[model samples]
Target: MSKIKVGVIGCGSIAKHRHLPEYANNNNVEIIAVCDIVKERVSEIAKEYQAIAYTDYEELLANPEVDAVSVCTPNYLHAPISIAALQAGKHVLCEKPMATSIKDAEQMIEAAKESNKKLMIAHNQRFVPSHQKARQLIEKGEVGKIYSFRTAFGHGGPEGWSADGVNSWFFKKEQAYIGALGDLGVHKTDLLRFILGEEFTDVGAFVETSSKENADVDDTAVCVLKTESGIIGTLAASWSYVSKEDNSTIIYGENAILRLEDDPVNSLVVQYKNGEVVKYELGGIQTNDAGGQTNTQVIDQFVSALIENTEPVVNGEEGYKSLKVVLAALQSSETRQITSL
Candidate 1:
């Protein structure tokens, strides 16, 4: 099997902790080039990965040896870089919140279509073992029909995560577009859609920058979402989880309630109205070393999709749809009115 020669744009924390490591670990992928505006970081990452270093992403994109690229740049740069990579005959594995706006997301999908390239969004939450099992159970009717759900993804601010630390682009409105909403909310947006097999039709949101200092973007947000099938739910994303991360969800159905990542020990639990309870000890979610968890399988899946000539589970259109929900929530917050998707 020919290895997929991969180039990574953005030598930031996410690229380092997730993309870079995961790609290197994948046997079918070879790190061909590393790009970042920060020359020092790019050079170091290139040396570590045994790949060439390029400060200009365009230069890296021009390399014919690169078969695919990971767009791990800021939210603002995702659309342009991914579209360009696709046009360059390279499959794209873009970090989530596909783009800052619905228009940009649509353009990205169109670009992939025109290029006949695979565009996979790195919404890693759906690959969580417990979340995967929960989806399977729900589809098998273990939860009957889902009536509602509440999902949240929260952690200490990006200061603790981004490579630039407290001064990261994540705190800048122009660069991040939307803070926790894009950084974390989009994961839940994608995860809920994947787990319930439903699309959100309406959103009412309350977005705020309540906790973080010296940050112009939102630190906390709560959105009420209704699916096409009348399943209503609350989606919350926050950067104010100083105590501990709260990445969990609860789904209420006609016969049972599924608690995903709600408990420390058991990753998933189902409570039945008939006095039966099932606990699942699925493995942990992907996180930084502080969380003592493994990285996500996103890079391997991207490589497989490209190699097999198959659409990734989270393809360009799927990403665009998930991003639409996030964009709708932001619009709802701005207009103080319910937004229809």
Candidate 2:
């Protein structure tokens, strides 16, 4: 196919603000359809993009013209929609946290393998320049051996991003499955995994609905992780930060200490044990909260992977692995003990 015909399933804030716009920007993609349970939302996005609209995702998947799909639905629906899309012979780019449970994520992976279709999860932080640079440094042995690290992602709350404001699906435990951990924590979990290139072996955490008045989900969460390579660290995620702090990993290695943060300019600060401290400031790659240019970069990579017949940078398996860390952390929080991954 000269241009990949794509369908977007889910017309929520993520679809409208991130996925659709990024897909629209890619010249090699032709958005053929949009689907959402809410007819008005689907119609609005469809009209905006000049594409057909459907209330049911299955109908959209059945369209012969659609070669790929962006599964922008809620946490619970991710697995079923992605699996069905792959079964319908369409490549899938599902949103992060893969699914609410490991079983569902495995099913999605199995569907992709069975259909021989690509299944990529949208872990956009992996595409950020600063994060990429950090990975490069680690791979090149510039930091020697990673010992421990800290990462975090925080914001005002879901009310600002959700279409329903205070009554959003993010607050509904049944819909979101978990609270701050799934929404913001997963990103850090994925990022730590990506940067460290190591799997977490155990996790201990504390989670609570500390600030949100009536929300059933957690507003704040903190976790400690032990990697298979003997590295240990902490990850913090919150939807209650009055002033957002998108700070992240401070990797201490034998040779250097690397500090990464997303404020005053995205940057990676490295302090060598030899007394050399270098700070590389990356002008924000994309819009901050929306993950701006990184979203487009990730989508471009996914499409390129399809055309090249190669594996995606953040495939279903990788998404599942990252999600396992979050799941272990949640289990740790609930049990007040270290949970094995």
Candidate 3:
């Protein structure tokens, strides 16, 4: 494929801020079409990119020119659209929290396998400058024999970001299925698995809707997770942090303690038991208030993988594994007992 032709489904915040702009800017990609249920919004985006507009996603998928698609629809539509795209002989790059349930995730993966197309998940945290640096240090045994860790992701709420504002599908249970646990916590779940290079085996949590009004989904979640190697950690996700966004992680090891996103000035910091401190002044993490643009390498990698005919880092298996931890946490919250995977 000389140039990968791309189609974007769902003209929401994620598409407007990340997918469309990134695809238009990628020299190796051509924006062939844009789709959304909203006619006005989709037409505007299509005109901006000088491409075709589609109100139904099926029409976009049927086009022979589109070689790939970005699944940026509501949480519930992620799996179905991804599966359909794959079956249509197009590669897929899906958003986080791949699906509402494990069965749907499995079906999506199978569809990709049957069609022999790439299926990548948008787990952008793995591409953050600070996050990449931290992973290298951990892999090099800089944090020897990890004991415990804590990671959290919190923000004001989706009302200020979503295209629909307070009436966005994010606030609806039927559309979103789960709340903070899926939106915010799933990112941390995927990030932790990437940085630690381990799978969570047990999950115990408290997921609740503590803030906001007139919505049924949860607003906050606190989870206790145990990895396969017996590494214990706590993960908290929330939409009630009235303050600024919080995306931070701390890891304690026998030789040192590593911190990430905990400091705005020094994004990645390491302190050894010998009383030595080192800091890396990487740029700020991408946030919603800053237009939610993605410069974290996800788009570039997705394009590269498609052009080179290779599997991306956050493929279906990796995405499914990360999503399992989040789903387990939700189950734990309901059963009031630890869930094991």
Candidate 4:
């Protein structure tokens, strides 16, 4: 196929700022269709992209012209919509969190396997240039063995990005499942796993809905995590930062300390124990919340995976592993104890 025909479900902030724009920018992708429950949203996107608009994703999935789909729906609809798209013989590029439940995640994976289609999760944090560079340095033993770390993502909340603003599905417990933990925490969990090259083994957390008086879901959370290799750290995700966004990670190692997305000018910085400091002015993480539409290296990679007949960077299994950490944190919060993954 000269170009992969694509359909995007859910005309939310992610779809508008990430998936649709990136796919449109990619030379190997063609926007075949778009779907969303909101007719105006879908129609506007369809007109902008010159694609068919559908009120139901199933109709778009049924179109044989669609070679793949980007599932950008709410957390609860992610699994079902993605499964339907995959079963319809179209590859799936699902948004983060994979699913709200393990059972649903497993089902989506099984469906993808059964259909022999690519299933990639849109975990863009791993695709950041600083993150990639940090991983490389760690692999080359530039940081020595990692000791502990603190990673966090915070912002004013989804009200700035969600299509419905303050009344979006993001604030609904039934649709979002978990709030900040699912929205932002999952990215940190996945990022730690990618850079550290390990799986989380246990988690203890305090997930709460302390912000947004009207929301039933968690607006803030702090998690203490332990990796399989005995590495321990804390992960914080909150929607109460009231000011600028904070998407930073600091990893302490035996030789040096690696900081990512933490500086005003540098993207990655290393401070050695021997009084040497290194700073890399690579670039900033894609701040979709700030109205940037730069390619996230997520959409094009999914397209490349389809064209090359290869697995995506963050596949179903990888997504599930990351998601399990968040799930465990929720359980830990409720039980007031550490929960093993």
Model 3 bad stretches (over 4 Å): none
Q: Score candidate 1 by TM-score against the native.
A: 0.98
Reference-based TM-score of each model: 0.98, 0.96, 0.98, 0.99
Q: Rank the candidate models, highest lDDT first.
A: 4, 3, 1, 2
Q: For candidate 1, lDDT tens digit of each residue in 1-341?
A: 88899999999988988888888888898999999999899989999999999999899999999999999999999999998999999999999888998889999999999999999999999999999998998899878888999999898888887889998999999899899989999999999999999888999999999999878999999999999999999999999988778999999999999999899889999999898999999877765536433868888788889888999989988898888988898899999999999
Runs in model 1 lying further than 4 Å from the true structure: 289-293
Best by lDDT: 4
lDDT of each: 0.91, 0.87, 0.92, 0.93
**Please, what are the lDDT tens digits per residue for candidate 3 over residues 215-286?**
688899999999999999999999999988999999989999999999979999999999999999988799
State model 3's lDDT. 0.92
Query: What's the distance in Å from true for residue 129, model 4?
Result: 0.9
Model 2 ranges with Cα > 4 A deviation:
285-296
Candidate 1 local distance difference test against the native: 0.91
Candidates ranked, most accurate by TM-score first: 4, 3, 1, 2
Clash pairs detected, candidate 4: none
Stretches of candidate 4 off by over 4 Å are: none
